[model samples]
Target: MTQPAFVAPGVVTAFCPKPTSHTGVVVMVAAKGDGVVVLDSGMAEPMPDALGPALELLGATTADVRAVLSTHGHRDHTGGSRALRDASGALTYFSADDEGLAGFAPDVPVTDGDVISSGDLRFEVVTTPGHTAGSVCFYEPTLKLLVAGDGVQGVGSARKLPVYYESGTRYRASLRKLLALEIDTLVVGHPLAWRGANTHVFTGAQCHELLEDSFAAAEAIRAAVAAVGPHPTPHRAALAVLATSPIFDHFDPGDPVEEDTEATLDSELRDLAGTAVR
Candidate 1:
């Protein structure tokens, strides 16, 4: 069980099953007295009880959970939705593009700018398709919170898969789309974005602050795609992109975690150190 921490006016975010300083997967709950909302259910069989613990942290559960909003179709974020929905009887929602992938269809098909309000809480869906064809982030204007499910990945290591992203152009557009929102608490699906220490989530000013790095990562990838061209060699093209990457710590998620992200960066620098000498 991940420790739940208060993030914004009506939000608490936690990394479940196990806790890691920089892992991107997380569960978030946003609530107000009359109703509650589970942003994303963790990867579990029965789907963890989102309300009891969420309200407990707030010193408040009535049978008033209004909905479960999934940011994308990825199993880690949406796996527990059906179970939670079955248990709480709350309405479940996700992007329509993900219906084929997530298995269980949502009660409400969410689209860009679609608003979901429960009592005093309101979340507006922003379509961000790079992470997945149907990936999205929810913005609570009142709470100034953004539930970014893998939308803005931490740069150190990323999961390379088609479901995660297909078009760099669409991905960059998605990042710019999110930059327009007003946010104080940003709950990323994973904490791929770096901090001094491995930090899974960003709260208050740090949310907006860390986005600078996230945006730069997007731009860097865009550049890589351009450099790769129409007929690029897979391995050489990838290494070339990594070489010119602005985000220094990019790696594959399946890559060994024992290797500290910084150490990989340092090794790259050491390899490049002799260039000036030569």
Candidate 2:
């Protein structure tokens, strides 16, 4: 298909592509002006078929891209980075902590509070680390748009709780930082882009409620693990807990479970806890 036209006046478009076995790849692209900045690049595959069309719509090409900004280092988000860099000769930008995961070291290592500007568009970095150690959210205050990676998904997807939290306490604090922003449009990585979802913006009050719920879910999972006794396999323990989490429950009641789902969940939790321990 011809690249989807730029959805917003200043924003260009492209698809993130399905990567992981679980979810479809999100549509990833850039919003360009004086400089070009790309969001996620999709899987660690070749340049997506839609990439050319999206760039064309912007009156640009991969060569015009100045920098690539990734919310985190997941394979799906960083997969196309190397190819894009080869194509556009653009510098990559990512959280310092995520350098190894994303493959390429960020030429521009973004820190919290860093402001990136391109002509009239400006993006402020918000360090939101619940999903991963270095996950971040890019906010364009003028447009009130938030490019939140996995920290928060679209309306129906479950928020990937920081399985690798350096500090559970700090991760929660970061969520508070996001909730405090004056966000009107939330452009998340997974699922579709959310526009004009103001009424659903989680307010400070609502955030606290969700935070508590998340913690409660975690605690229940933990409790179930404890009850399963010391020798319980991590995979089984996690599955038992996840089976009871309200977040998982919110989805369809009888969806078929992936054969390796429990194992994958265990691996993710281990990774998350390992980060916390370090």
Candidate 3:
């Protein structure tokens, strides 16, 4: 029984079970009716308990849900799709590029420039292939709100290690693309952090600052890859990065290494070699 709260007009935020501020969920209610839209479900089973509370926040119900937009194919984001759809019969959406992820099958395969409408909300999908091949952000121009799942990771989440499976080059480009948007509110899948501040929501200049910080962090990784060269042992290379990169905080070189960190380092190395292109 998670309590959902309004972060912006007509938009409610719910947290997945046992969530931190970094892993909050977003729900959008139609301005003209009871139609509801959920963005990025959750990571585990039984669906997110917050959904019911979110609907109540807007005076809506499961039957009023018209759409469920997944930011990417990551289970933490897409895991609740089937349950949500089963409950509300809402059309599910995710980038067709990510249909290959386990258990992902979007009712509407989304692409860049595609528009999804629910009630008065018209979300223009912006394809951002980085965190995952099909990572995307939904922007509603009228509200100036962008619901970016994992497409933008500042310095990573609570662990403070950014994760990107696809091309790091493309990830940086996606950050640049988001920086160009006219966004008043930015909602992300995790509490991505910058300089130790972490949250899933950003408003006004904080939005641009967060985008800039994310880009800068990605750029730092790129620079590290360039310095370390492409063939170094993955673990050693990651240690070298952790030792020198200011993008990471509260991390020590002696700490046990994370596989995703190593993977990101390898991906960046490939990017530097021009071999990571998707």
What are the runs in model 3 whose C-alpha is more than 4 Å off? 1-3, 18-34, 230-232, 275-278
- For residues 1-278, write the lDDT of model 2, one tens digit per residue: 12454545677656655745434555575888776778878776557444777777788777887777888887777778777777778877789888777766877899899988888888888988855778898888877777766665432343232233334444455766766777656665654212222222343344344434445544444454445544446555555556665555543323454443443344445545665579
lDDT of 3 by residue, 98-199 (tens): 888737689999999998886677889999998888999999888898988878877676544665557788898998999889999888776665666766
Best by lDDT: 3
Off by over 4 Å in 1: 18-25, 50-52, 60-63, 158-164, 228-233, 240-246, 250-278
lDDT string, candidate 1, 85-204, tens digits:
776688889998888878878899999989988777778899998666888899888778888887876554343311134444565678788777777778777645365445556777
Q: What is the TM-score of each predicted model, taking all chains together?
A: 0.77, 0.72, 0.88
Better of 1 and 2 by TM-score: 1
lDDT score of model 2? Answer: 0.62
Candidates 1 and 3 compared: the better one by lDDT is: 3
Instruction: Tell me the deviation in Å of residue 244 in model 2.
Output: 4.1
Q: Which stretches of candidate 2 lie over 4 Å from their true place?
A: 1-7, 154-170, 192-231, 244-246, 250-278
**In terms of TM-score, which candidate is strongest?**
3
lDDT of 3 at 16: 70
lDDT of each: 0.65, 0.62, 0.74
